[model samples]
Target chain A: MIVIHADMQIKPEKREAFLQTVQPLVAGSQAEEGCLRYTLTQDVANLNRFTMIEVWADQDAVDRHNASSHFTGFFKVSTDFFALPLKAEKFTAADV
Target chain B: MIVIHADMQIKPEKREAFLQTVQPLVAGSQAEEGCLRYTLTQDVANLNRFTMIEVWADQDAVDRHNASSHFTGFFKVSTDFFALPLKAEKFTAADV
Candidate 1:
């Protein structure tokens, strides 16, 4: 499986709104064929910092999800609340 | 549950050694009562960067794990391989 961790720093005041806005996309992505898990989490130390952890069957699965309309729409509107640019890390689970 | 994501930048030359060094602690941590999952993964694009994703049942579970001997032992020796200081993020899954 492939793991994607996207870190976003949202304006503190907009945290609630941002979460509400992305809830639909989270659900949509989780329902995709290759999606194993998609969860949105807030850092305990910084309520404004959020991380979305996504597990996909493969890179192809991720590509399709990214191309989906919900994702496209989320990306378009999601930038409005960011206090910092999104920082993402993708991983291929180590067998060892 | 509590989720802890630790991002570590290992010296390129020490990558393999670092992994080997921590393998025992990884196994030891996974065996703890509160540990739901403890995985060490490398970034697909950045070979020298490693992220340890740990899931614990709760704060107390996490505290106990941190206070364990394996954790203290690993911290003492593992700093030898670090290329950068550790960056850790703790998260609480949002119910919404």
Candidate 2:
């Protein structure tokens, strides 16, 4: 499995606007093939920070999701709300 | 396997302090038995939000980690820094 954790720091004043714009993007992503799960969550202590956690069947699925039009459109509109650049990390499950 | 995604909102000014307090807890968690992976990440757009992603071999491992003394100590110190209550979600991989 391929897991992606994306952390975004939205400006405090722009958080609600950012979430509204990204909700549709998340909805579209959840409907894609190979998307095991996709979730967006905000931090309790930090009003301006959010996390996007995604689990895919494999790397190919993740790649396809990133390349899809929905992601591109969301990125274009959502980039302006960031307090800092987005940070994404990927992990592959280790064989037992 | 059990996967946990914990989203925390830290007061903007208390973020650094919270991180400092939680670093040791993360290190301790990573060393525990049945811990596949544990990672703490901040959001790119939200400066005050952070996420804790943990993958365990099973539910037992997660339960043990939560009950460990290290986690309890860290929680005591870190709770005061939260801007809101922490929210945690759990997911189990679906059989193919």
What are the candidates' C-alpha RMSDs? Answer: 15.2, 7.5
lDDT of 1 at A77: 90
Candidate 1, DockQ score (0 to 1): 0.04
DockQ of each: 0.04, 0.10
Question: What lDDT score goes with residue A22 in model 2?
Answer: 91
Leading candidate by TM-score: 2
Query: Native-vs-model 2 lDDT?
Result: 0.79
| Number of backbone collisions per candidate | 0, 24
- Give TM per candidate: 0.53, 0.59
Identify the leading candidate in terms of lDDT.
Answer: 2
Which candidate number maximizes DockQ? 2
Model 2's chain A TM-score stands at: 0.92
lDDT of each: 0.77, 0.79
Q: Lowest lDDT 10-mer window, candidate 2 chain A?
A: A87-96
